[model samples]
Target: MAAPVITVSNKSLLHDQWQLLQPWFSYFDADGNPAVRYQLWDSGATATSGYFWTPTNAHWPANTTIDVAASDISNVWLRSGSAGGSETLWIRGFDGTDWSGWATFTFTTIPNSLPVATVEDQSLHVNQWARVSTLLSYSDANGDAATKYQFWDSGTAATSAHFWTPTNSHWAPNTTIEVSAADLANVWIQGGSTTGSETLWVRAFDGFNWGAWDTFTVASTNAKPVVAVADHSLHVNQWTRVGSWMNVSDANSDTITKYQFWDGGTAATSAYFWTPTNSHWAANTTIEVSASDIGNVWIQGGAATGTETLWVRAFDGTEWGDWDTFALTTTINTAPVATINDQSLHVNQWVKPGSWLSATDPEGDTITQYQFWDGNAAANSAYYWSSSNAHWASGIAIDVSAADLGNFWLHAGAAEGSDTMYVRAYDGTAWGNWDSFALTSTNTAPVATISNQTLNAAQWAQLVNWTAASDADGDAITKYQFWDGNAGANSAYFWTPTNSHWAAGIAIDVAAADLTSLWVQGGTAGGSDTMYLRAFDGTEWGAWHSFVVTTAV
Candidate 1:
C-alpha cells in the first residue's frame, strides 16, 4: 500500500484529552439496578433537578477496531470515569467535517460505558487510547471496513541508506577510507558487482562488516572489474588483456566523472591511486584496482591463497558486462616485476667462487642490465658485452683478473625502480605475476676496523686488562684475543669490543691466576713491547696504540 501525502496541523488537540470524565449522583428506583444522573452541561448549559434526560447506555467493545466515517469523525463524544459528567474529547485522524463513509480502529471495553472518544481535532497515534464503541454504529451492508490510512518512515530507520540509491542526502564519493584492521583490507559496494554497464557502488570492509558503497560507472568499451586494497583506499582497475600488454584508458568511458578512493574503509575521497598510464602493465599481468575510481574500494588476487570482497562493475561501452568473480588474496605492496633465475652477484665455493646470474620471463621481456664491476672497468666489465668482460643474470662468470680490487659500485642501469613487466600466454591471456625491485651495482668486500690497545698491570710482571680494540678489516669483527693477561679468579675483562678475527679466532677467556706467563720482552721504559697478536694479514700494517709502564712509587 502506498503511503499518502496527508499532513495534519495537529495544533488544536495536542493536549486536549485532560478531562474526559466527571462525577455523578444517582439512586436505584426500587429496582435492583444502579442509576446515574447528569442534567447539566458545562458549556453554559444549565441543569434542573426535577426531570431527567440522559444518553442511552450500551455494552462497550473490549479492545476492537472502531469503524467510523471520515466526515462525521468529529461528532463523537467520550464519557469519563464512573462520575456523573465527562470531558476532554478527541476525534482521531478524521478531520473532515462529515463522518460520511467508515474507518476501522481497535479500542478497550469496560463493564460500564467509559470516556471512549475525546472530542478533539485529530485522530490518535497508533496503539493509543481509542473509542471502540464508535465502530459499532457505522458499517456497510457486507461488513467491509472502508477507510484509508497509512504508516510511514519520515527519515527514521534502523539502517542507513546507500550512496548509489541517489537519495542526495548521503555521503559523496572521494571521501577518505580511514577505517582499519590487522587483517587484510576489504571493500564493499552498494549493489556490489551487478551485471552489465550499470553503476557499481563502492565501500570498504573486512570480511565481517562494511562501509557505505559509493556508486561509479564503468567504461562503455569492453571492461571488467580489477579490484585491490591499499592503505584504506580501494583500486578498481578495468582493462582488457591483449597480447603481452593491455589496452587501457587513462580515464574510463563516459560513466565516472573522476576516479576516487578511500584509505581503509573510511570514505575519505582522494585521487592518489595507481593507474596503468603511470606504468603500463604488461598483458600477462593481473592488474588490481588502484585507489582512484570509488571510495574505500579494494580488490584481492584470485591467483593467490586469500579471499576478500570487492565492489566493481563492468561495461562493454553500452551493454552491461558480466561481473568477474575471483577469490581475493591480499599481498604485500610490490613495486615492479624483476625477472632473473639466478642473482648475478651471488658467490659460491662449489662454483669455483664465480657464478653468473640467469633470468628469463616466460614472455621473453628483457631488462637493460648492469652488474657490479670487480676488476678494472675493462678487466671485469667485458666478456660477452661491453668493452670489458661482464656477467648477466645467466650461467656466465668472469675470471678473477688482476685489475679488480677496491673498484666496485652499484651503477645506474637501463630500468627504473618503478618499472613493471608482464607475462604472455598462448591462450591470449595476460599474466600479472612478476614485479621486480630496482637494481644497481654495490660493493665487493667488507670495510675494516681498528682499536686502541690499553694494557694495565698490577706488577710489571703480570698484566691486568686492556681497553684498545679496533678492526681494520671492517666486516663486523668475528673474533678477539687476550694476551699477557692471566686467567684466574682475579681476572676481569675491561672494555667490550666488536667481535673480530683476533676476538673470534684465537681468543681465550683469561683468569687472573695464570700470571706466570713471561713473554714481555722488557718494558721498563716506553719502548715498543711485542704482544702475542700479529698484524692483520701483515699486508697493510695496522696503526698501533702503544701503552707505557708507569713509574713505580
Candidate 2:
C-alpha cells in the first residue's frame, strides 16, 4: 500500500489569545484505500526532533498523536500553548501502511481586544437621581473583565466634564469609577427650567483601554406647572372672575393648553362656575383649554358660606402635571349699609324716621336694629320724644330707647329752627354708617279783628270786616268763618252780604263780600245779638273775635 498524500491544510487561524483554535485538513489515499489517521507537529516539517501536537482540551484529550476516521479528517481542534503569539502546526495523513509528507499551517493569536459597551436608554424626571449600573453593560474579546466605567456629561462639559472616580455623588464628565461602585454611583442631572429633553454618553474600560462610547439618552421628563393664589373672599350671592386672582406658570415655557379645577369644599358648585363668556360648567371639570382663555373665568358665590379649596392641574400640550392647591374662602360676611334723608317736622310733631331709613346688606342679611343718638354735636342736641323715651334731653347721645324708631317725635318746644339727629342700622353681623335726620319746626297763628257794631231795627248793616285778620307770621289770611250766637226765634242771621244766603263754616271770599242783609224786623222784639268770627293764615287759625248787633225797640 502507498502512503496517503496530504492535499490541503488550513492556511491560518486568527483569533484572540483567550480563544481556542481549531485547524482543518484534507488528504488522499493510494490504491483506493481511505486515509484513516492523521499526525501533527509543532515545528519544521518533521515530528521526530520537534515537539508533537498535543491536545490540552478534555474533549479531545492530551496525546502524542491524534486519531480520526476518514469521515472526520477535517475535525482537528488545537489550542494556543501560550498567550498572544503566532504559532505553526504541521499535519500529515497515514493509510495504515505509510505516512504522507507533512503539511504546514499557522496559528496567530492577538492581544486582549477592546471591550464593547452596551447601555439602555433611560428616562428620568428633572432634578431626580438614577444609578449608572442599571443602564450599563460590557464584554471583552480577550476574556478581560470590565473593572470600571467613564461618563461624559453634557451639563458640565465645559468645566469638570468627565466622571471616573468612585463616588456616591453625581459624576463629573470623563472620570473613571470602579464597576463595583456603579450601584453607588448615582447621577443627578437636570434640564432647563421648562419642559425639554437631554442626553448623556458613557463607556466601559477593562483596566487597559476604554471601549467605544455607548450612548444612553437621558430623556428628561416634562416639568410640572405650578399654581399659586392668595386666599380670597366672596360676598354671598356674588360672582367674581378668578383669572385675576390666580397665578399660573410653567418652567418649560410651554404654552398652557388646559387646566382641571375642582372644589375641595361644597362652596364650588357646577352652576356657579362660568367661562369668560358667562357659560356655565361643572365643578372638577377641565376647561379653558386655550392658553389665552384664562382671563375673566367666572365663579359665583352660592348662598352658602365658608372656606373652599380649589385644586388645579395644568397640561402644557403634554402629560398632565401634579395638582396645585389654592384656597377660596366662601364664608366672608359684609357689613350692611344704612341710608336716610334729612327729616323735617313741625314743633311738637311726631314722625317715623324709620320710614325714611333705607338699608342695604351685601349678604342679603336683614337689618336687625335701628340705632338713634345725638352725634355729640350741637345739631344732635335737638329735643326728641317717643312713647318709650318720653323726652330726650339735649346732648343725650346715648340710645335713649331702642323702641319707637318708627314713631319718634321731634319737638323744639315753641322754637322754630333746625336740628340734626343721627341714626345707624345693623345687620346681624355688623353696623353701618350713621345717617342724619334734620328736624325743623315753623308756623305761627294769625289774629282776627272785629268791633262791636250798632244798627237800627229794619235797617241793613254790614258785619265785621273779614279783611282785618292779621298773621304773626306775616302770612295773608286764607279764609274767614263766622257763627251766630242767638237762639231760635231770636237767632241773628246773615246773608251773603251780597244779598245771597250764607252758611256757617263755608269759606267766604273777603275780597268781594260783606254782610248787607244783616237786619232785625221792625215788629220783632229788639235786643243785642252776639256773633263769632275767625280767620286763618296758610298754616294755622287765629283766635275768634267777638262782636254784637243790637236792634232798636
Candidate 3:
C-alpha cells in the first residue's frame, strides 16, 4: 500500500514554557485500510522519543512506536518545550502494511508576551489636576500585568512640556516610571494654558518589552483670573494710580489682558478723568489687551468729596472675573482764607476803607460779612458788633457783603483820645484773623478875636492891641488870618497891611512883630465895617471870629 498522505497543522500561540498545545493532523490511506497510526518526533527526520496522539485518553503519550489508530490521527497534540525557541515537529503515518513518509512542521514560541496599553481621554478646566495612571491601562496576551510605563507628548518619545503637577513641577517627555512609583509619587498632570485639546502618548511594559504607544486627549477649558484691589484715599484735587492699589493674579499662569472700571460718584467738573498718557475720558471706560492702559487717574479741584465705591474687573485671555470694589475717599477740602489789613481813621469821621480791608477765599468762595470790635477784643462778644444789640459805643460797620465794604464811622460819644478798631473778614464758610488799626481824635480848634475899633474915612486904625487868638483842648495857637466883610478873598479891598492879606495868601504866624503890624483901614462911606478872623490850633482851624469897625464920615 502507498503511504498515507501526511498533513500537520501548526498553531501559533503565546504560552508559558511547558504548557500543552493541541494541533490537528490527518492522513489518507491508499489501500483503504481501517487501521492507520501516526508517529511524531521532536527534530528533523530523526525519530527521537517524543509523543503519540491517543484519542481515547485525550493526551499525547511518549512512545517511539506508532500505536495510534487512523481514527485518532486527527487528535494530534504537542507539548511546548521547557524553553522558548524555533519549535519543530516531525510526524509520519503508516497503513496496516505500508509506512508513510515523515511530515515536518515548524513554528516559533515566545517566552514572554508584550503588554498593550489603552488610554482614556480626559476633560477639565484650566488649573485642574489630572492623575497620570488614571488615564492609562494595559493588558498582556501572556496574562502578564503591567510592570512599568513611559509617557510622551503628542509627538514621539522624549518630547517635553506635556505634563505637570499642581505646583507646575514636570517630568521630561518619555520619562520611564514603574507602576509602583506612579502610585507612590502621586504623579499628576496639567495641560497648557491655551484652551484646546492636548495629546499624551503612553506605553506600558510587563517586565519585558514595551508595547506600542497609545494616546489620550486632554480637553482644556478657559479659566477666569482673580483680581484684588485695595482701598485708596485722595484729595479733592488729587489723583491715585492704577497699579498702586491693585493686584492682578491668575490660577493658570495666564497674562492679564483686559480691564474695566466704574466711576461710582460725580466726576470733577473741570478736569474729569485721564489715562496714563493724560488722555481725557469724558466718562468711565475699559481697556483690552493693552498693558497699563489705565496707569493713573485724576481728581480735579472742587470735586464732590465723599466716600465712594468703585468697581473693577479683569480678564486672563478668557472670561471676566467677578467685579471687585475699590474704596475711594475724596475727603480733602481746603478752607477758604480771608485777608484784612490794619487801618487808620479820625474821630467823627465816616469814610470808606480802601483795598486794606479786602478778603480772599482759597476755593474762590464769596466773602459774606465782616466783624468789627473795640480794642482788639476779637473773641469777646461784648466788644464786637455781632447784631443790632452788640455794636461799638461810638463806631458803626456798614455794607458788609461780598460786593463792598461801605464805611466805618466814629460818632458823637467818641472822645479825643487814642483808640483801637479791630476788624475780621468772613467768607461764607469761615472767619479770618482779626486786624487792628490806630485811631486818633484831634484837639478842638482855637479862637481868634479883634476888639472893636473906630476909624474915619481915609483914616487908619491901629489894631495891634485888639487882635488876639486862643485854643481849647490844650493846643497852642500857631497861625492867624483876617478877612474884611466876612466875604473872604472876594470882598473889596478895605484893609491894608503892605497890601498883603492873610486869607488869600499864606497864613500869618502869631508873633509880636506880626500882631503889631496888623491894621484895619475904613471904607470910604461905611457905617460899620465887618471883619473876620480865624486861628489854627496845629490840627484844625477855629470858626470865623467877627469884629465891628465903627467908621465916621
Candidate 4:
C-alpha cells in the first residue's frame, strides 16, 4: 500500500482561527477484500503503539483510492494563542493485517490580532507631579490580559532608549501609579528640546506582541516677567506721578508680587520694595513721588544743573528680572539789573549816553537782553517800549534823541525842562527793576541889531553896522543874514552879509545903486528903505532887528 499523503492549504496558521488538513491513500489486494484505516498524530502528542483513528470504526475499503475529508478527521490537533510551535502532523494507512510507513506534514501557528491602546495628552506646570492611569483595554483576540507597556519620546531616534518594556504585573492596566517629580522634571527637560509643544509616545503588548505606537502632546512651561518705564524730564521744583506710567507683563500669567527701586545708590532689597494693595502688581500702576522727595537732587552754581538716575525692577513671585533705568535733570535761573551813565540830555542834540547791565543766577544763567523806558512805568508795561522800536538805541553808549525820551516833549513843546529816562535788564526768565536818569533841554536862539541902516544914495558905499548877536541860553551865534524889509514879511529879499563883516564889527558895505534897487523893490522909492538882520544859535533863529536907509537920487 502507498503511504497516505497529507496536504494543507497553508504552511502557517493564525492562532485565532482553525486550519484544514486532508489525508488520502491507495491500496490494492488480489482479493480486494482488505480493510484499510488511517490515523493522525501531532508532534506534541505522546508516542503510542495503539493507533488513534478519527472515527470509532476507523476503517475503509482497500485496493481502491480512499479519501478522508477535513470533517472525517475532525479531531486533527492544532495550536492556538501562545501555544504555537513548529508542529508536525503524522498520518498513516494500515490494512487489517499490514501497516504502511508514516506520512508527515509540518506547519506553524502565529499570532494575528493586534492589541488596542491609547495615550492621553496632558498639560501641566513645570516640575509638577501627578499620577497617570487608564484601563488600557488592551487585548488580543487569542491572547490574555498579560499586557506590557513602555514610554517613549517622539524626539528619540533609537528604540533602545525608549524600549523599557515592563509587564503588567506591578503596572497592570487600570492601576494608578505615581509619576515622580523627577519624572516630570525629566519630561520638562526633554520638552526644552522642542519648545512650546512636545509629544510622548506609548505602546502596549499582549504578552507576545506589541501594538502600534500611540502619541500624546505636552505644553511647555511659562516664561519670565518683564518691566519698562516711559522716558521723562523735569525742572528743579517740578512734580510728577508714576502711576500708570510703567508697563509690566508675564508669559505665565503670573502676578507681580512687588516692585523695587534704586536711586543710583544702594542695591534694591525687600526693605525698599513696594507692594501693591492688590497683592499682585498689574501693568500701568500709578507710582507717585513728590517734589519734596527729589529736593536733594537740585543743583546750584557751577554748571547750573544736576542729574539723577533711577532704576526699577519687578518680581513675579518666582523670579526677579533685570532692571530698567531713567534719567532726571534739575535747573535754576536768576534776574538781572541795569544802570545808566548820563542823567541829563539836551533837546535836538545827539548825545551818546552811557548804560550797562548785569545778571547772575545761582544756576549760572546768562543775560539775554536790556530794555529801556522813558517814563516811570514798569519795565514790561506797554508804556515802556522794547529795543526793537525804531527810536530805541542799543549800545554801551546810546545816542537817543530828546524827542524819543518821552511824550513830555509832545505836551511840553520844547520848553526848557528835565525828565527821567529808565532802563532794565533781562536774564531770559526774569526782568530787573527799572533804573532811571535825568534829561534836560536848555538852549535858545540869539537876538541881533543893525547899527545904522539910514544912508543917502550917494553915500551908499559907507558901512552899515549891526549889533553882535547874543543867545539867551549863553550859546555863541553861528551866522547872520539880512533882508530888504522884515524877513518874516519879505522872504524873497533875504541875503547873507558878504564884503564888510566881522573885520570892523558885524557890518556890511551897501552901494548907492544897490540901495536904490532895494528901495524900488521894497516899494519905499522916495521915503526910506527898511532892512532887517537875524542871528542863529545853531538850533534856533533869533528875532529880526530893523534899520532905516534914506535914498536920494
Ranking by TM-score: 2, 3, 4, 1
Give the best candidate by TM-score.
2
RMSD, one per candidate, in order: 26.5, 39.8, 42.8, 37.9
Overall lDDT per candidate, in order of appearance: 0.26, 0.57, 0.57, 0.44
Better of 1 and 3 by TM-score: 3
**In order, how many clashes per candidate?**
134, 19, 1, 9
* Cα displacement (Å) at residue 111, model 1: 37
Give the Cα error of residue 445 in candidate 1, in Å: 12
How many clashes (backbone atoms < 3 Å, residues ≥3 apart in a chain or on different chains) does model 4 have? 9
lDDT of 4 by residue, 358-458 (tens): 33444443444555555522222112222444343223223233233432121111435565666666554567677776555555668887565443433
Instruction: Please give the lDDT score for candidate 3.
Output: 0.57
Q: How many residue pairs clash in model 1?
A: 134
Query: What is the Cα root-mean-square deviation between model 3 and the actual structure?
Result: 42.8
Error of 4 at 513 (Å): 23
Clashing residue pairs, backbone N/CA/C < 3 A, model 4: 242-287, 243-286, 243-287, 244-285, 244-286, 343-438, 451-465, 454-548, 454-549
What is the overall TM-score of model 2 with all chains considered together? 0.31
lDDT of 2 by residue, 68-138 (tens): 55555444455443334555666677777788888776655454468887768665544333445555676
Candidate 3: stretches off by over 4 Å: 9-24, 34-36, 44-76, 79-84, 110-127, 133-203, 207-553
